[model samples]
Target chain A: MHAIQQQYWAVRDYLSPVLKESKFKEHGRITPEEFVAAGDFLSYKFPVWTWEKGDASKARDYLPAEKQYLVTRGVPCLRRATSLAYTDADEDAERLLSFGDSSGTADEWVETHAGRGATVDSAANLGEIDDIPDLDGDGLASAMADVSIVSETGATVGETPDLDDIPDMEEEGLEDGEDEATMAPVVPKAGGVIDASQIGVANGNLLQVRTYDVMITYDKYYQTPRIWLLGYDENRTPLTPSQIFQDISADHALKTVTIEAFPHSSTLQAASVHPCKHASVMKKVIERMNAGVVEEQLAARKNSGKHQDKDGKKKWGFGRKGAKEEGVKSPVEEEEVEGMRVDFYLVVFLKFIASIVPTIEVDSTTAF
Target chain B: MPVVQFAPFASLVQPGFWHELTRMKIDVLRLSEDAITVNGSYSVGRSIRDRETGHDIALGCNLTVGEDAYQKAPQLSPMSVHTTGIFKNFNTIEDFKAADKAALINDVVSKIWDSIITTKDTSLLTQFLLITFADLKKYQYFYWFAFPAFVSKPAWQISENGWKQADEEIQGHFQLESIYDSLLKTTRSFFLVKEIGGITEVGSIEQYEEFFAGVAPENRVIGFLDPSALPENPGWPLRNLLTFLRAVYPSQTSSVRVLCWRDSERPTAGKPWRSRFGVVSIGEGDPTTKPSAIGWERHPTTNKLSARVADLAPMMDPKRLADQAV
Candidate 1:
């Protein structure tokens, strides 16, 4: 049955229609050429991501040698998904209603776990409270001020032993900074967009930290970028597959996330966020951002009316802010209906992905 | 008081670092296993605390190196300190596995010890070692990262309540910003912090000898851009620094204040940069005797003292890429 399903997928992938330029804006899918262009733009803007070539043995002819896939390593996952405030039913219902109004597909949001985005809202509350006293019962001030004797070790200042004579302190590794002491959870600032600077300094527990090495590959059949994740524990040890699942939202863990062998590597298996619904979701996000663009343009148009063409040279700015007027409603306005540039496709895609995996922190740098 | 146990340095090798190694292997370093100097960096620890679970998450204390690891001089960034390390890429996985890991670490530690006794550049104490074997055919890499620190005779101890937040001592954001800016300009990972007539000052590592002689012992504070986020502990780099201090300082019994200089890489409004101040006492070690070092990274899952593997075939394998492409 698995072999049959694989065959069916292969045939379906081969038969899938190539994304047309017109549908690219409407459907949020792209051709291989467009994928490269978008990848280039993303890498240019955010240097955190860079293109890389796979093994010479598995090289793809469609993409350039140096640009086979994109990767950003050591993306910190400060907390587990469950640690974030759960998406309340009311907020989920509100999101479903808005998604229905925009894309007429509300159930898709519930199915994909993409709508479990309560953390993104909380993430925005970063940087409001600056000096939170280390509420870790061991008071910060008292802990630093108190003095104690070190008579237990029995070694005085001048009569210390040589380094060679010292026993292996590997067992003492536990006492080293991996202290089990906990601090009061941080209450995020009430309202604001997340600042990239604050993303690294947020109130995260040092004991349970995890890091993710992320990979973004263009999915040929789905016509979208697919993300793969390999996580490591605080000690930089690789997290088991089940351990990785703990960081992923429960909604998407068993559903969309699949453990499969990556196409470029032969020996390793990684968890990949399936790209099946990426196109439609990306299309909805693009449209929403474009609507925001239109609203801003409308606001600009209203503001520009105050200045008017006082000099009579038609100094009025219209759609996209820089287009010239040629009487028949500038061609830029027509394009403005599908306003956002294809270069921003990956940015929007990441924003959608962030909602699904709120703790991974890959999108924090790119969101702005 | 408890022994000052340092948080181990976590190695975060960027994929680009491997890609660069691959390129150098094919184009420049074909069967060579010579030691090459590479640059790595660590920033102030950024962690979050969960008040609900009371779980303190250590965001990362990563000694990271990427595509720019091969650069001769660091392009200084405000967020992190660009420290130096040695990289040895073996030709085969067997060579990587069979090699005497202790001897390899000792060799690097010996070099660090030599530099500490001879060089004025205290930055030399921050040296680390990395070994790897890239299986180009399989797109896999077997690697180990070790941050060597000599075992002190009298283990360094954190005096009771020895560490506290230094937001006030440093004055405020303006002074902290100035100090952070100076840190980048000097490019020294470790420095001497002195208070000259109520005005705080930071000096390069070379000045520690003179600074220690001139200042009162109570005011002897050494600062490093701390990589560990945990409040009670310092990062792995401090281990070597402490060892170096014991060798060079004039006093046999030195009670020095340690400033774990931490700040947000990009300071946003309302979020001020903060640091920690701790008092630690180090006893003199026998300068002639070489200390046993510890810093081999543990294997992620097996929890054994073994090398970790990374398979990049899906991204690096050409045939696989082609097959995945439309």
Candidate 2:
């Protein structure tokens, strides 16, 4: 593994304490793959990718077949820290062919590297990379195509191909041969609003999806819900994909903008330890929370009688937790608002708004 | 011996006046050349009667003569000597009236004889009395007037028409006009002497020296004047009495001084007294006569007489004296 990848794992090891101590695992496990994905996502959104790119000699090599076929076409794969599967393919194609298994292939391979037992599955036709289906039905090929294309080129897909007549690819689907129709923009359900009740299995198995489970785990553990772009401004106008990416990229570092869920009242809400400067955003968040739109799932588990002692004995009638419980419904019920759900898209949108907005400092030296 | 000539004043008078004058007893005894002795007595009697009852009583009359009674008596001018006696016993108004008439006749006769025989020029006496009285009345005023003149006039001219002259002239005019009024007034008589020597026997030589050294010219005079009258001389008797009383009693020393000055010439043995005392003299003649006589003495070595008069011209000027004194 490259040094940065090793370093990333080391840092991840350090973060595991905070995650475990915060009962993140009890909420749901965040797999190594997921952790790396989160890191990669943060890196792409910030300048961290530059730090992740180490020595060029350690750059990932591709298979001969992949170099001949997939690279001639256009697709990108991450190469700074070589994936073991890709590295294994250069050493032994037969052993690396295990990645072509039918189900949980990536999961099985990752489990073996982690020194865990793996599940066996039937050998599946490694389908024509271009013919692989997108689970999101977003009309783009499977991510496997990205891996294959990157391996074949032995060069990053974002760079130009040797054949000048060949069509060029844009990081966004803007090139002539880019197949813009296949790269269907996520319309975000036309003003989709996720309420707190939809956070569990009821709302189309939200926790089953890795992204949603990650978001929910983060919400339960850190009381920080991951927010996605809802394709709208505060005035509820749809934003283009370019605008959504631009907004998200610009505010990737800010915690408030990265949270997914919002309160389910009349306004939107996000949480951060640091004070927010944007009065409108803060006010909206506060109004939504006050109006019971942003449901807090752990309100009951958090000692609804806020006066309870550390040992969980009630010291007085409900305080903060009681107020929160009174404002929110149980996780199974809908929030009674038709189009309100504190979901990832809204979390990202709110996060983008929050990051673009400035932070405020008050008499911070004083205890509130 | 020089023939003793007496003016025949006794032959010229009426018999009753002469008889009354001769009836006055006159005893004179000489004790050396400088002293004399005299003794005499007089008495008066009256009858008392009751108006309602016809009761009558007779007062007794007695007289006795003391030895040398007048030996040391203050020397006075002859006009002051007089004597008379009267007696009466009555039971009614007729007798009392007759006795009163006799007493009045005796007093008038004695006074006339006294005026006739004792005429030793009373002018000096009168002037002295008037000036002393004036001084007592207005010494401060006179000092104020004289002081300026004394400062302005020459030292010698101070006695000429300066303060002293001005003082005397002012006094003489006032006296000439007011003498009759002063004499008619039944006032006690007083005498002033400017020079200690003008008195018969005053301070001894040593006493005189001491007195002269201590008493500035402004303070040398001795006399009394009526405290209410201005420009009248205090008589010699009052001056001598004040000096003698001041000496003897020593307590009356603070009484104001009054001096009388006249011509610079001495009085002849038989002439009316002419003298000046404690006054600045202006003439160029001998300074050792009368008013000047006060400072003269016989020189012990040469036996020659000389006068050393105080330069009183300064003191005669109130301003000069005040300046020098201050």
- TM-score of every candidate relative to the true structure: 0.61, 0.14
lDDT of 1 at A289: 59
Deviation (Å) of B11 in candidate 1 = 3.1
Alpha-carbon RMSD, each predicted model: 13.9, 72.7
Candidate 2 versus truth, CA RMSD in Å, comes to 72.7
Residues A1-368, candidate 1: write the lDDT tens digits: 43355557757866766554546667878877777887897776665677877555656566787788887766777556544333353244223313454445432554223333333343443332223322122232222122211122543211223221212312223213422211112222323211112233343322255788888887778888899897765555455344555666555664676555565653345678888888877776667656655554454465653533232122221111222222212322443443556766676666667656767877744322
Whole-model lDDT, candidate 2?
A: 0.22
DockQ for each candidate?
0.06, 0.00
Query: Model 2: per-residue lDDT, tens digit, A207-258?
Result: 1110000011122222232222222211111221222222221222233332
Deviation in angstroms for A138 in model 1? 39
- Residues B12-110 of candidate 2: C-alpha lDDT, one tens digit per residue: 011111112112212221111121122222111111221111222111111111221233342211112211112111223223223332233334333
In model 1, the Cα lDDT at residue B263 comes to: 64
The per-candidate count of clashes, in order, stands at 38, 58
